[model samples]
Target: MKHLVILGAGTSGTMMVNHLIGKLPKKEWKITIVDQYKTHYYQPGFLFLPFDIYTTQQVKKDGRKFIPKEANYIQKKIELILPKENLVKLEGGEELPYDILIVATGTNIAPDEIEGMDGPGWYKDIFDFYTYQGAKALRNKLREWEGGKLVVHITEMPIKCPIAPLEFVFLADSYFKNKGMRDSVDITFVTPLSGAFTKPKATKALHYLLEEKNITEITDFNIERVDYENKKIVDYADTEVEYDLLVTVPTNMGDALLERSEMGDELNHIPTNKATLQTLDHENIFAIGDATNLPTSKAGSVAHFEAEILTENILHYIKGEPLKEEFDGHANCFIETGNGKALLIDFNYTHEPVEGTFPFPGVGPLQLLKESRANHMGKMAFKWVYWNMLLKGTHIPFVSANMSTKGKHFEKMES
Candidate 1:
């Protein structure tokens, strides 16, 4: 039997395995999935943890529950990938040979990459909501604190859920106002980008919301180091932003195993064909999610979209057929804009987020580029969809992997 090995049973890997289970005959192929952790996190829930909207218990599930019975689930850390030999080494020195390899190891936040970011003030005066531990610690910190200078900072770009930092600041504004401490707290959004968001139209809309909520924006600031003792962050240009509490999104990088194996780019992301999701160097290996160096938002939705195309490409590869170059960097996100309201944006590689209704042009229950209570409800309802449908490899109706311009209105924003 030909062996198929998948690394990191996260969203992409889990979905891909499930998709392959139905397509690949059990008699002809054997599938194996490897991951160190057994518990899978609803990563998007991490964004709401700091505000007490979600608890640690609400976002976790057994990883084995989603992996199909036909696939062998090995709970172990990967040591290296020897692509030339078609073999993967595990932590205990066991080598697994595979006819095909899939890498969905995903990216992680590296707070240690930044000086003093995780020093004396870590989980105390400074914290991040990227991980469960950090999010829970921040929750505790926010509970007892009367407010002061609260700064939400991003160290670099290409972070998973790129819009989450902005959402955090927006939620914080509403959280402080609800606690009757709006005037006592000062919120500032410090980003390396020139605007509130990467897309021009969405940036204009989100920047307006930041202004409306009285949040300060410090743009184009590249971080040098964190002066934890002084309760300040210093940029490369020597500009300092002081804070009583700092919510930082650190430098994000792919699995260190990729770097050790010398199979990844400078940031340790697998070099991939932008259109096909195939690793540029190896025909037998493919990558998806944040693991690949795709010029797209490293969000769960993007992974879901990429899986639709990558699964088809994998099947084509197995059949000795020409692979379809169909992935278009399709990504959509719901921006939580406080006070029971949110906004959604849908776009792809060639188009910026435009104004329109989602799923349907004139009859959407969810609006795009505009804030509404319905959008917030849709965002909240997504958690249920994620657990019951997305991970199960079930197709979500009306949401195609390819971006549709049918419902989108292409128009310039009023800057």
Candidate 2:
């Protein structure tokens, strides 16, 4: 029997595993999924964790609960990936062979990548909300502390949930106001981008929102290193921004095993065919979600959309037929913008997010690029959809693998 091996059981891996079940006969193929961790986190919920919108109990769970019966789930560390031999070396020196491989290894926070970022002030005066532990630590710090200069910074780009740091600052503004310290705590949103976001249009909207909230925005500040001793982040041009509390999103990279395997790019992301979701290096391998070096938002919705197209391609690959390039990097994300409101953005590799109605043209229950309470509810309701429907490989109603232009209005396309 041929074997299908999947790496990582995070959002992307979990969904991909569910997509493969029952499609391949259990008698003919054995599916195995490996992950280092037992518990799965709702990573997007990490944004709310520090602010008490979501408790740890709500975001954390055993990943095995959602796993399918047809696959063998292995809870072990990946020590190495010998891609040339199509084998994965586990911690105990055992090797697992695969006829087909799916890489969903996902990305990680590398605090050490920046000088002095992981030093003395980490989790004391400085913290991250990306990981469960970091968010929880930051939560504890936020509770007892009196606020001063609060700097919300991003070390680099391509981090998960690009809007989250901004969300944190907005939430912090609201949080401090509720605590009656709004006037005292100085809030600054520091980013490396020339503007608020990667897309210029959305940047304009978010820039206005930041101004409305009375939060400061520091643009084009490329962080070169952190001076933990002085509690400052210095830019490449030697501009220094000091912070009493540093809430940072560190540099993000793919799994170290990918680097060890000699099968990934500079950031350790696997080189993937953007449309096919197949690895450029090997025909027997496929990549999905944050593991791919796709020029798209590494969000959960994108992974779900990519999975639909990749599932079809996998079947074609097994049948020895030419695969269709249907995946268009479709992604839609709802950014929670405090005070029970949020904004949604929908775009693909070629299109930037434009102002329009979503899911239904001119009759959307949800609006795109506009802030509303409905968008917040849409964002919250996704958690249920994720657990009950998405991870089980069910397609979201009205959502397709390609970018839907029916409800969206684009002045022009980029890329």
Candidate 3:
């Protein structure tokens, strides 16, 4: 029997297993997924945890529960990957040989990368919401704390869910308003980007929203270090911003195991073909999700789209057929604004977000690049879809892996 080994039983790996189990012949191909974690987290829920929108119990589950019985699930920490030998070594004296390997080991936060970030103020005055424990900790801190200087920050770019810091500040605005302490708290959004977001049109829209909410926008601020004792963060240019409470998104990097194998980039992310989702070095090895150093957003929607393309390509590779390079960096994000309203943005590699209807050209239950109550409901309803349809490998209706321009209004770009 041919062995197919998948590392990291997270979102992408779990979806790949479920999608390929029935498609790939069980007798001929043995599917196995390996990871160190016993619990699976709905990472998107982490953003809501600080705001009390989601409880911790709703976000975690047994990792084995989502994995299919048809696939072998191994809960072990990976020590190294001997790609030349086509084997994965566990922490103990065990090795699993594979005919084909899939790398899905996701990204992690590196707060220690910044000096004084994890210093005296760590988990006390300085907090992060990117991790499960961090988000829960911030919730506790927010509960007992009175309002003060709340600085929401991003250490660097290319973080998972890039707009989450903005969302955090927006939700914080609403949270404090409801608590009747909106005037007592001052929120500031700090980022390394030149604008509120990466794309031009989305940035314009988001910048307006930030101004409307009276949340100060501090752009192009490259952080040098956190001055914990002084209750301030300093940039490389000697600029400083003090905070009574700091909720920061730390620098994100791919799994360290990739660096150990010398198969990844400086950030430990695997070099993969952007469209094909296959590793650049080895033909039989593929990468997906936050593990790949693709120029696309490191988001769940991007991973979901990549998995669909990768599944088809894997079958093509086994049959010795040509693999399709059809992935267009398709990504869709729901931006939560305040007051029971949210906004949606859908775009790809060459397109920026525009005001239009989604899925349907003329009429939409969800609007693109515009705030609406419908969009908020769609955002809330996605939690259900994520747990039920998405992880189970069930195809989402009306949503395809590719981007569509049917309803989007694009302005003519000058050469």
Candidate 4:
């Protein structure tokens, strides 16, 4: 019997397990999943944590609860992945050999990477709402925050759900207004990017939103270090901004096991064929979710799209056929603009976000690049879809693996 070993029973790993369990012949391939963690976090729920919209208990479940009974699930930490030897080393000194290896190790916050970031003011004056624990802590701190200079920061790039910082700002505005401290609080967005977002058109739209919301932006501000005792963030240019409270998105990197194996890139992300989700060095090895160095956003939607394409590729590889380069870097994400409304953006590798209607061209249940109650509901409704449909490998009816350019309003290009 052939052995298929999967690492990290997170969203992508769990989905792949469900996908293969029912698809592959049980007598030919036996699947085994390994993860150190017991509880799985509803990561998107972290965005709502500061607002008291989601509790700690609501966002957590045993990781084993999601794993299918058809496969062998092991709760253990990975010490190293020996791709050349086709084996994964467990911290307990046991090795699991595999015919096909799928790495879904995912990314994690590395606050200690930044100087003074995890120092004196770690979770007190400076709090990160990225993790379940961090978000819950922020909720407690926000409850008594009397309003001062609130710094919304991004230490570096390639964080999971890139738009989360902006969403945090929008929600914070609404949060303070509800507390009657809108005027008393000064909100400043600090980022390394020269504009509001990755794309220029989206930046224009976002810059307007910032002005409209009276939120200030400090562009190209590459944060060099956090002065914990002084309550300030200093950039390389000697520029500094002090904050009464710093809500920051810290550095995100892949697992330490990647470093030990020497199978990862500079940042510890696996070198993968972006479209195929296959490892560069090994044909039988594949990577998914935040673990891969794909140009697309490290998001759940990206994982969903990648998984669909990867499933096809894996089946092809097993049959000794040419793997399909089908993944188009398709990603869709919602930006919470507050007041019970959110903006949706959809695009692929060659295309950036443009004005458009989604799902349906003329009459969308969810609009694109524009804020609406319907889109907001779509954002909220995804929580249900994530737990029920997405992770279960059930196909989403309205959403396809590829991006749709129909109903999108594109600006005329100039030569």
Candidate 5:
């Protein structure tokens, strides 16, 4: 039987298993997925865990639960990817050969990339909500804390869920206000970018929210090191931002397996065809989600969309057909602005997020670029959708893999 091996059992890999299991002929092929962890985290929920909005139990579950019984699941650390030999070496030195390989081994926080960031202050005064441990620790810290300078920071660009740091401060604003300590906590958002976000329109809208929430913004601050001794962060320009509590999203890089194989870019992200989801170096290998160096948001929504497109391309490859250049960098994200409000942004490679109705043109139960209680409800409801529909590879109704621009008000580009 032909073997198809998938690296990583996270959102993207799990969805691919679900999507292709029914499509690929079972009599001729077998599928196997590998990962080191037993628990699968609802990463987006990590954003809410610190403020007591979501409990530790609510954010994680058995990784095996979502994976189908028919597909082989291996719980072990990946040692290396021998792409030339079409073999994967596990930690115990066992090798698995494959006819096709799909890489969904996503990116992770690299706090050690910055000096002193992961030293004495880590998990004491410095914390990151990107992991379950960090989120839970920050929760414990926030519970008893009287509050002081709370700095929400981003180390660099292309981090997973670029909007999450902003969301953290917004929730911190609401969290403190609810506790009657809004006046006691001082929140500052520090980023290496020139603005609150990468896109101009979204940045303008988010910048307004930062001002409205009275959260300070320190832009273009490229961090050099963390002065754990002085309780401050220093940038390359010698600028310093002091803080009592520092919650940072450190530099995100892909799995070390890519680095071991020498098949990845500087950040360890595989160079992939942005449109076809195929790895540039190998025709039989494919990549999706945060594993690829795609110029798009590294969010779950983008993974969901890419999974759909990649599935089609994989099928074409099996039949010795030309792969479809269909994926357009589509991404949908809900920006939680706290106080029971959020803003939804939908865009693709050629489009910036504009004010538009989603799913249905000019007729949305959800509004784009506008904060409302309804959007917040939609954001909350997504957790249920993620567990039930998204990972299962069930296509969301009314939402296509490609972005729709019919109802959007786009500004005219200067030709």
Candidate 6:
């Protein structure tokens, strides 16, 4: 039997398994998925965990629960990827050979990349919500502490869920207000980017939210090091931002397995065909989600869209057919604005997010680029959708893999 080995059992890999299992002939192909941990985290929930919105139990579940019984699941650390030999070496030195390989080993926070960020202050005053441990620890810290300067920061660009840091501050605004300490807490949002977000239109909307929430904004601050001793962060330009509690989104990098195999870019993200989800270096190897160096948001919605297109491409490859250049960097995200309100944005490679009705043009139960209680409900409902439909590879009705622009109000830009 031909073996198809998947490198990770996260959202992308799990969805791919569910998508392909029924499609690929079971008599001919055997699927195997490998992951180090048995617990699968609802990463988006990490954003809400610190504010006591989602309990620790609500964010994680058995990884094996989502994976199909028919597919082989291996719980062990991946040592290296021997792409040339088409073999994967596990921590115990066991090698697994494959006819086709899928690398969905996602990106992770690298706080150690910044000097002193991971030192004495880590988990004490400095914390990151990207990981479960950090989120839980921050929750504990926020509980008894009468807040002072609460700095929500981003280390650099291309981090997973680029909007999450902004969401954190928005929630913090609401969290403190609910705690009756809104006046006591001082919230400042710091980013390396020029604005609140990468997209201009979205940034404008988010900037308005930041101002409305009375959260201070510090832009273009490229951090050099964290001065743990002085309780401040220093940038390359010698600018300093002092803080009492620093919640940061550190530099995100792809899994180290890619680095070990020398099949990745400087950030350890595999160079991929953005439209096809195929690794540029190898025809038989494919990559998706945060593992690929795709010029798109590294969010779960992007992964869900990529998984659809990749499923088709993989089938084509099995029959010795040309892969479809179908994926268009489609991403759909719900930006939580706190106070029982949120904003939803949908965009692709050639389009920027604009005001529109999603799923059905001119007839959306959901509105784009507008904050409303309905959007917040949709955001809360997504956790249920993620666990029930998304990871199971069930296609969301009315939402296609490619973005639709029919109902959007697009402004003409000068070339």
Total clashing residue pairs per candidate? 0, 0, 0, 0, 0, 0
Candidate lDDT values, in order: 0.93, 0.90, 0.91, 0.90, 0.94, 0.94
Residue pairs of candidate 4 with colliding backbone atoms: none
Residues 1-415, model 3: lDDT tens digits: 9999999988899889988988998789999999999999999999999889999998888989889998999999999999899999998878999988999999999999999999989999999998999999999999988989999999987899887888899999999999999999999999999999988899999999999999999999999999998999999999999999999998999999999999999889999999899899999899999999998899888899988999999999999999999999899999999888999998777777778998888788789989999998888988888888888888889888998888879663332
Off by over 4 Å in 5: 412-415
Relative to the true structure, candidate 4 has a C-alpha RMSD (angstroms) of 1.5
Between candidates 3 and 4, which one is better according to TM-score?
A: 3
Model 1 — which ten-residue stretch has the worst lDDT? Answer: 406-415
Residue-wise C-alpha lDDT for candidate 2, range 1-415, written one tens digit per residue: 9999999999888988899887888788899999989999999889888988889998888899999876899999998877789888999897899989999999999999999899988889989999999999999999988878999999888888788888898789888888898998999999999999988889998999999989999998889899998889999999999999999999999999989888889889999999999999899999999999998888899999998888889999999999899888788989878888999999888888888898889889899999999999998999889888988899889877788888778866654
lDDT of 6 by residue, 1-415 (tens): 9999999999999999999989999999999999999999999999999999999999999999999999999999999988889999998888899999999999988999999999999999999999999999999999988979999999998999999999999999999999999999999999999999988899999999999999999999999999999999999999999999999999999998898889889999999999999999998999999999999999999999999999999999999999999998899999999999999998878778879898789989899999999999999999999999999999999899998887888664333
TM-score for candidate 2: 0.98
lDDT of 4 by residue, 101-174 (tens): 99999998999988899898988989998888899989999999899999999988888988899999999999
Off by over 4 Å in 2: none
lDDT of 2 at 98: 92
Model 3 spans with C-alpha error above 4 angstroms: 411-415
**Candidate 6 stretches greater than 4 Å from native:** 411-415
User: lDDT, candidate 4, residue 139?
Assistant: 95
After TM-score superposition, what is the CA distance of residue 317 in candidate 6 from its true location, in Å?
0.6
TM-score of each: 0.98, 0.98, 0.98, 0.98, 0.99, 0.99
The residue-level lDDT of candidate 5 at 9 comes to 93
lDDT of 3: 0.91
